[model samples]
Target: MKFDLTEERQMLQDSLRRFLGDRYTTARRNEIIDSETGMSAEIWSQLAELGVIGAMFTEDQGGFGGAGFDIAVVFEELGRAGVVEPFLDSALIGGRLLAEAGQGEKVEKVMEGALHLALAHGEPGSRYDLNHVETTARDGVLTGRKAVVMNAETADLMIVSARVSGDVADQDGIALYLVDKGTDGLTIQGYPLLAGGRAAEVTLDHVRGTELFGADKGYQALADVTALATVAQCAEALGAMETATALTKDYLMTRRQFGRPIGTFQALAFRMSDLLIEMEQARSAVINAAGYFDTDQRDLYVSGTKNLMGRAGRLVAEEAIQLHGGIAMTQEYELAHIAKRIVMADHRFGDTDYHLERFIDLSAA
Candidate 1:
């Protein structure tokens, strides 16, 4: 019930805040985001050098002995700075899964001073149910299509989920596999998204890999890890909302209309005030949900965080854009950056509707 970060977590947050101050800026972020690879290997390597890429893994997994809250702290810092590195895709999803599956050898190699693995779980048909994996794995061969996989095109490796000899919707038969990039029969097609980030359609035409985690209730692992992932995302979304609100407020203060600053106008000021309140609520939900995850509350906390953050993130993003007027939509303005991050927040684990339904199902049970 208490929402306070311990000394260790605060230290982690402060370290990331300092590191991001020196390493990332709007200009640097823009350059990396618009680059040929749509990411910065140099920055990613630097994160590894700082031991942040593996900050959430355990010592047994060859990591620096960290946890979900540590990872969430990093995500908050990244969101505050608009850094476009692959910590979420790599360390959170792919690396965490491998670490949990007891793939120490792979981690020792792949996670050595870098973490940029991708999760190839989503199919064109699966929507947000990760258990609904249509990708097939039989006799060491994987064959199926993955759509809009974040960081797949540039990741060093991928942790893919596949159905093993059963219907796609069966939760018990799914397995997680580790596949090297550019393997034979793996076709990757990259494209730019509306948010200017990159995602790829990955087709595994009988691709082969070793099974890292099989049908031994890894679904529980997946659920727990994904809950942590969702809460971390909510933190990021809250950060984005805070940033957008600041930008809007600053613009209002400086932008003149009739005879004084537009911020002084009652109508606009009230709207900004409302947004500030909403942003704080969203932030509280983020911290509370994160604390719940850390405390091992399995059922309601994850869905609660997703719901609160989904609504708050969307509301703040939309209001910030509206308050900024036409300038917000244009790429020339910085508000667009926060806005894009907010827009992309919907697909992080699942959209608001998806999580709400999940909450309902859990409540019913």
Candidate 2:
């Protein structure tokens, strides 16, 4: 299959790249990371004006291109720039769930970047299990705690997962609810993440929420939304790996050893070649997962793609740092931040071992 972006997607990619290149410098990103909110409302509004957020949803959801490629294109650019905005939380996962639940007006606000939403699903010990929901919801009341909820502190609303009937880890009886921020019985403890973003630990004590769709329908929606997020994350990792590999190649060409460029050395040249090959393989896997997202085999492809990306991201990040020596370790260097993001991306959604296990189980079944 052809791995090239469509004309419209290509245009979107180009425009986003130009915008980020011109505005989102490393200094600006560091400033945002150090800010009280850990993000920039001005930048968020600018991105919305550029239609970056809207392009991630379908026309029905107030976006023109909600396909897998559309998500891949937008996130790849975000990763390349090391952006810390909550677009992934607000647009991809939260917006998709809201749209699936028929909350069209809220989704429109999300698409316009007028509102921010987060998915508070993972608990303290859930470990990567999408079905491990220990939070309880009954009679419009929610009670539980969610761990490491991305962008939760800044979200105007949160889509929380809770169990209505079945035991924890059961796929059935899982439900999602929309909880407005600052509601009674809700508390959020926010902290900065290692990868230049903010996350929160949220506790809900008899917090009342409006259910999004019926309780019986949330399991499938959560599964589908998480799968899509995993695929988009893989694309982001691929972009970061691409940047890391290029930086490594440039370092090899410029850093001299034995009165000559290190790239001229046979061993370093071979290592660079290997990294390039692995990056290409990872790219192909992302394209395959994106292309198959609408098919019955989407879960399989997403699992396999995430597994490949997790391993590849680790390899690329480590090798890039090693090849660059001390300069790569500094926070001021672009490579340091990009490599950190790539390494941390594996821990999100699922890690290499988790996805490998899932892939094996699915293949056997």
Candidate 3:
């Protein structure tokens, strides 16, 4: 019956909010987004020192928290501040994958923000399918390109997936390797993302890598880590939606029309009410997904959550823009950045259509 966050989680949320509020102004976030790296090393270090990175992992993994709620809590704050840092890449995905590979020291460096990690799994045309790894490994070298390898440009290490045994799409043939940043035959074409952050098109030509897991264990680990990523993303979208609605509300309340606040109009009031309802529903889905965590039932909840949240996020973004007009689209404002983040979240991990099909498939099973 208790739907509230645990006391520790609440405290973590408060601390993150306070820190970001004090230091991460809208202008500062915009500057980071505009930077070549699309992130800030100094800010990243501050967050790590505040225990933000460590909060995303379990105690057994040398972190104080690793529950699904823990991830949701941390990511929600990140999104609220429009943080473009690689916390999701470093902690929820990479840190956990390192733990799975028994690379505890690397994980420690990650928690300390001394290292960054990216998972180079999705290849060209992969389109959010975790099993569609076309990159190949042979004779101790990896070849092929990884698409949208988030944070790979800055990552000291990458967890690359390659097919070692069967067809590219075969679930059983995928393996994972740890490739160092400066490895021979490894190349990255880094680019800033639309919503903020850096990703790369990583090319490997017989690149040497330390084997992390063979096909036997690789697929399951990749799947689990991806599911965790999906959960974190959905929580982030919820935070972005919160910002969008708040911004829209402020605009409506303050922007006078015909000598009256536009928010006083019944039609606008009804629409704002509808947006709030949708947001609450999205929040419910996030809570449900977080509760399932990484268990067998996790896929079901995550799929449902991602599907619903994606749709709701799009609606929130579009509606907020309509209410706020052209100003909402300008980069000078916080809502513009927040709205973009909300809308783009649907495209990552899996989109609404993908997760809806996945949810139905799981339900039938």
Candidate 4:
């Protein structure tokens, strides 16, 4: 249980931190978020060139490191920097979905940052269930609306889920289709997420898409890919918690209250200690999930880790803002965005409630 990065992973971590630290500053991030795609094309290209995207996959998928720890390493850095990039969607989730569907060349392009992909799985009222697809695909044509698909606007291609047969909630009837951007009968209405990304409400009216995966196999692949994305997101939240805690600690020491720094107050000091402990616990959960990511125990660990991270993220967000008082609420300050991102991260994939139930069910089984 000595959860330390290997020599190569350490190098990768060091390089990513340095690169993001230098370029993705608060001001620059704001610019990117306000951009049309909610991401920076220049930064995306640079990251791909630096092999940051490639590091998340295996050699067969055209990446050097596709381990669970590799995913944790990459996303933790992304969280630390508060980057708004679509790496999570395009590179991690969509890229792997393509590969799992036997589309290696597309994954290669995704790793290269030349192509972007979105997984259009969640539909209206799906509420995080992988098999709750109501969209239909017949004769290679799709019909139905997908709600809140991440990175949809930037994706050159999207893997949409549909039901070719059986009832909507039945797990066996699920299928996946590959739809290109600007395809006929495909309409996307995208908006910024509360965190730092873009999502779209997609409507397909008899749109034809290539079948990447069919009934009986699509659900499991979606589950596995979503599980991996969950791990990456939890790691990202851990990184954000680290940044928020550090910012609070620094503020405590420097900000004056009465005759001395507010950190001297015993009550404030205790709260800060609690925040640190919660953060460490969150880190442990992320490490555990990432370690078990490729194993049979992935579901158990992922659910438990996500549930912990969600609660911990809320705690850190609230405590950090309270510790900073009025300054933290200001849009110009760093903590404002970080705090928001932490809370919003909880709601993505599954929130605290969803993961807690998932953990209970999986444990019983």
Candidate 5:
């Protein structure tokens, strides 16, 4: 299958790369991550103005491109820059969920960057199970805890998952609610993550929420959204791996020992070659996942892609750091952040082991 992007997507990629290259320097990203919100409002607004957020949705949802490839393209660029923006949370996952629930106005607000959203789905000990929701919603009130909610601290709105009926791990009777920030009985404990981002521990006790797309029905949508996020993360890891490999190559060529560049040694050169091979395989997996998204077998492909990316990302990050010596471990260098992001991307949505198990389960079915 042809993986070439259309003209529109190509232009979008070029424009976004140029913009990020000009503005999103390592120092600037550090400042953003160190800020109170752990993000740059100005950069978010600029992304919106460039139609970056809008591109993640379909035309029906007021976006020009909403295909899996669109999401992959945007996220890959973001990953290459090591950007800390919340596009995956706000636009790809939360906005798409609202759009699927027929909340067009809310999606539009999110596309405009006037609203920020977090999905409060993961719970303590949920362990990558989308259906393992201990949070309960009854009588339009939510009561329970959500752990490690990304962007919840600064989000203007939150999409929460709760069980309205049935057991905690049952797929049926899973529901979603729309809760505004600062609501009574809603508490958010914000903290920084080791991966250079922020997350919150959200607790709700008798906090009222408006049902999204009716009550006690959203498990399928949640599953689909999670798969989409997983695919986007695969793309992001591919980008980071690409950067890491290139940096390692450059370092080997310039850094010399015994009156010769280290790259001249067969051992180091062979390792670099192996890294390139892994990167290529990871790229192919990402492309396959993007193509399969929106199809009946999307979940299967997503799981496979994420598993491959996780392995590839870990290999690339470790080798890049080792090959570059101690300099790659320091925060002052760009490769250090890129490598860290690549490694951490594997843990989101689901880790390598999680996706491998899921892939086997889906294949058996």
Candidate 6:
């Protein structure tokens, strides 16, 4: 299972890396985070113009006819830049939801960059179970609440997952609906996360929406979407780990203590070597998951990748901070941004603990 990128993929990765280097910076990132929405509309438009938003969609929807791996490459570059454009939420999660749900109009609108989209999947009771939704949709009305909805404030279209009225647990009763933002009886209260990203609490008081997708092949699309998004996150985590480790290595080489560079200290150098080993393992798992995404064995690979990458991301971030001393926590340092985002990424989709149990379950099955 070799996961080597083709020449085309390598070219795409290089282009995205250059674009992020030239366009996104620490100052601009801080400014965007300080804004009310914690994102930049102009930057998002620029990304759309560059075809970053629609890179994973088919050409029928005005996209570039790319795959999940292509989107993952872009995500890695975004992670290296510490960007908060909600690209993963809008382009990867929301756009894929629309496509799987067969919302042709919504997919077209989002692909054209005319409308931003968000997915309402997490709920208080679900506790990171993507299918354990309590929200209910009946008679064109949706009710219940969602928490930790990303990009809720800026999205024009919302894809909501809800339990079909009178459904059983672990069953195929979950349905997805399309609701326009500002619809009557729908309320969104949002705030910035500890990371640079933003999330919201969504409440639907009998909110009305059109059913976009129902249980197809036993509501399997939910799992597929989450798996696909997790692979993208693995890509981001790989980049973050690489960047943080490189920065720490450079700092250790230049910063002198006790008449020698800190990197000369065997203790710190060995720890960094361990981190590199974990990062290489994570890279392999991420690329393998991407390649196996559409196969019947996808869940196994996804769980394994999530577990490995989640640990690598958390470990690299913590190690980066520890090596940098107090300056690492300061907002003025790029390491701080990377650390926070990495911590957030650790919990996104599912945390290490969550993925461990998921991996065990899949393997047992």
lDDT tens digits by residue: candidate 1, 1-365: 55667776677678877888777767777887788778787777777766666666777777764565676677777787777766777667777777777777767655564546888888988788867888888977899999998888778888777888667687788887878988999999997665555889999999997787776654666776788788778877777777899899999999888999988999999999999898878877776776666664655777877887888788888989998789898876777887889878887788888889988887777
Model 6, runs deviating above 4 Å: 1-4, 60-62, 215-218
Off by over 4 Å in 3: none
Clashing pairs in 5: none
Q: Which pairs in model 3 have colliding backbones?
A: 57-65
Residue 174 accuracy (lDDT) in model 6: 82
lDDT of 6 by residue, 257-289 (tens): 999998899998898788888878977887778
Tens digits of per-residue lDDT, candidate 2, 238-321, equal: 888988998899999999979999899898888899899999899899998999999999988999999999988998999899
- Runs of candidate 2 exceeding 4 Å displacement: none
* Candidate 1 minimal-lDDT segment of 10 residues: 106-115
How many clashes does the backbone of model 5 have? 0
Error of 4 at 196 (Å): 2.5
Measured with C-alpha atoms, the lDDT of residue 331 in candidate 4 is: 78
What C-alpha lDDT, on a 0 to 100 scale, does residue 48 get in candidate 2?
89
User: How does model 1 fare in lDDT?
Assistant: 0.78
* TM-score for each predicted model, relative to the true structure: 0.93, 0.98, 0.98, 0.98, 0.98, 0.95
What is the C-alpha local distance difference test score of each model? 0.78, 0.90, 0.90, 0.90, 0.89, 0.81
* TM-score of model 4 vs. true structure: 0.98
Ranking by lDDT: 3, 2, 4, 5, 6, 1
lDDT of 3: 0.90
| Residue pairs whose backbone atoms clash in candidate 6 | none
